[model samples]
Target: MRTVARVIAELLVTFGLVLALLVAHLKWGTDDYTRRAQRGLSDELDKVWSAQSVVAVKPGRAHAVTPPAPAPAKGRPFAVLRVPRFGASWHFTAVEGVTDADLAKGPGHYPGTAQPGQVGNAVFSGHRTTYLAPFNRMGELVPGDEILVDTATLTHVYRVTGHRIVLPTDLSVLAPVPGRPGERARRASLTLTTCHPKYSAAYRLVVFAELSASRPRTT
Candidate 1:
């Protein structure tokens, strides 16, 4: 009986160690992987923006409405999202899909939604507590906060309208008008979503913003 008890105790310790390692990896190891991925994505954006892939706005078209470009292939990155309120260094490459693999690269654009600067809801989803947690500080955003999205040609600036906490099953937030199904979107809008309360996917925290301006890219 003594030998059996010792074996059981050893097994429990081993399990505990494994669990601790997993927690650490989820919190820190994933962050390391995400940082490396971000660097690569940033480099890709730099190349595209500096290359012939971009369309240069004319001298008199500074405020001209730039139409939305066609969606890129899934998992391919197409833009960069930045929140000034999050800090000067806060930015994430926005990709084409929100699947596990795509989000592992960065914040993802929901397929079938409006693209940046378009007159509809442009939804982006990101991990709240892992993979560098780009939206980790999303809760700190106020109604007047600015969300900037940079494509190869223009920077779309969105002003936060409001935010809400909803259940995981809340599909209304994904509507073309956001929280208003079947309603026509009259203004260009942006919605950001992430797992709520940190480390829990029970609910989603959604932030709503509307496009306030678009600036032609200079550099």
Candidate 2:
């Protein structure tokens, strides 16, 4: 009996140690790696900004003219995203694709979705528990909170409408009019997504916002 108990105890201890290591990697190790990746992406975004121009307009003074931009290459950084509710210093470069390799660097724009400021749903997905956890505090956001998307030509300012927890299989949120598939959209919308409840992909927690106003890129 003593030998059997000792063996079981040893196995349990080993399992616990492995779990701790995995948690540590998910919580801290990945953040360091993502921060370095973000720096590289930011450099690329700077180049895009230098090469592009927008007809400058003061915020809330004139309507923003959102001319379509060419589709960005996969894994390339195309925009800068900021949520003041996350933190004044919080930002992540918005990359072109939502592939694993692309999101490891920053929040990724869903391909085939509307680009920022376009009159359709522009979706972005990011990790909630690993790789900098860019959308970690998404639940704290309420209606009226701002989501800023800065592209080479304009800064789209989105206001939060609401949020929902949906099954991973839910595709309605990807509609041009979110949650209303098959409808034509006439206004720009934003959708941000991440795995729900943290450390699990069983469900998705999505935040919906609308383009309240936009301004020409000044910086």
Predicted structure with the largest lDDT when compared to the true one? 2
lDDT of 2 by residue, 79-180 (tens): 899998877798889899999988888899999999999999999999998999998899899999999998887789999999999999998999999999
Model 1, span 90-168: residue lDDT tens = 9888889999999998899999999999999999999999999998999999998999999878899999999999998
* Candidate 1: worst-modelled 10 consecutive residues by lDDT: 62-71
TM-score of each: 0.89, 0.89
Model-by-model lDDT, in order?
0.89, 0.90
Lowest lDDT 10-residue stretch of candidate 2: 61-70
Regions of model 2 farther than 4 Å from truth: 54-68
Residue pairs that clash (backbone atoms under 3 angstroms), model 2: none
